[model samples]
Target: MSTYLIGDIHGCYDELQAILEQVNFDSFMDTLWLTGDLVARGPRSLEVLRLIRKLGDSVRIVLGNHDLHLLAVYAGIVRNQLKDSTTLLLEAPDADDLMNWLRCQPVLQVDNQNKMVMAHAGITPQWNIDTALQCAREVEAVLRSDSYPILLNTMYEDMPNHHHWSEELSGLARLRFSTNVFTRMRYCFPNGQLDMICKDMPNKAPEPLRPWFTLPSLIAENYSIIFGHWASILGNATPEGIYGLDTGCCWGGELTLLCWEDKKFIRIPYAGIKHW
Candidate 1:
């Protein structure tokens, strides 16, 4: 069974289909692992969600920052950011079901069988696999509960009470910290605080805010991680086992997929869908 890991789709349904066909993804045998951000920015966010949902158990997804923003918008916690496409998803009849399914998904997924960690954004420097998984569970619990909207309402904040974890953390303070790491992380200050605002390349990430993977704390963990968030960096910021899949399909860039078994990249160029 071939397991394929795809980068940020960002509502590029046509590209997603083309890539799957190129790989000849066998629904029954070949597994599909999405690097998240499955919707928004492109013209077919709703179609993308429906297609993946139809794939059922064969598809594994982690939530990205955009995905979380979508949920927040739906819950009336935030305004819609996907003016181009997400409104279609929000207006669809199955919007409730789709949002429910999306929120149920983990922000961080640990695949011991595949020997990798999957999160929309990269993991924080302070957490190892076990701690990271535990933190993810905390956020997952909040998202899946009736109080989910409460978290969404306050989720869009910079950094947190602290960059590093502490056993004393509780309530939204703890939840926000973990959620940001899993969905919005990239660069961080040397003190371990995430640089949540800079969506630029590592070189442009500003002083004291170095790429997350370059930190000694995170590098020491040394686990294979597959993530897609910083499309600006694309696949250039590879630090050994870390892989970036989001090639900015929403911005006229290509959608790339990585074959897990052999680590091969299968790229499908965008079909000229004008986002502007």
Candidate 2:
């Protein structure tokens, strides 16, 4: 049996199907790991979510920022942004189930035997793999709790770019920063300040903000990190021991699939859009 890691699907069901065909994915013999953002910014969000849910234990999905946002919106804690693109998802008959599944997903996953970790965004330079998993669990607990709706109400806005963790950051508000740092984060100010605003390449961020992967004395040097959500920058390439899978399938780029154990990659070019 082989494990495959797929990049940000972003609701592109057709592309996902095409890539799965390329890999010859088998439900019984193969397992799929998704880097998150399984829905959003594309046409078939419902279809993709349903397909993944149908896959059940055959798949492991680490939550992405978009997934969290969808949960917030579904719970009525947050309003829809980006031109009501998620409206259809909210109106779906299985919306609650989909939202529940998304909220239950962890922000980080580790395969100790393989010395590998997967998250939607990259890990913080300051955090070792164990600490990152611990932090993700703390948030995951809140997301899974009865207070989740209350937490979602507070999930908006960027938190302070400081590196220190605070216990006072309960529920969704606490998650906002963590999610951004681990999922959407790219660059940061030298002193461990998060540069959440800039989405461009690492070189383009201000001098104070360096890409998280470039920080001095990174902790996860011994393990390989797999992540998506940097489609605009890394595309479907593996850099060093870090794997970036988001090929911007929803934005007219390729959909990427990587075989985790063997490091084999398959990319399906976008016949729909040209650029993300």
Q: What is the lDDT of residue 254 in candidate 2?
A: 78
Q: Give candidate 2's TM-score.
A: 0.90
lDDT of 1 by residue, 79-114 (tens): 776455789899999999999999998887777766
lDDT of 2 by residue, 1-276 (tens): 889999998888888899898888998999899999888887788889999988888998898878877887887777787642677888899888888877887888888877778889888776676667777887788888877776556555654633344545554555666766666777767776667677766656667777776676355567888889888774533458888889888888878999977888898876654333
**C-alpha lDDT values of all predictions:** 0.85, 0.77
- TM-scores, all models, native as reference: 0.95, 0.90
Number of clashes found in candidate 1? 0
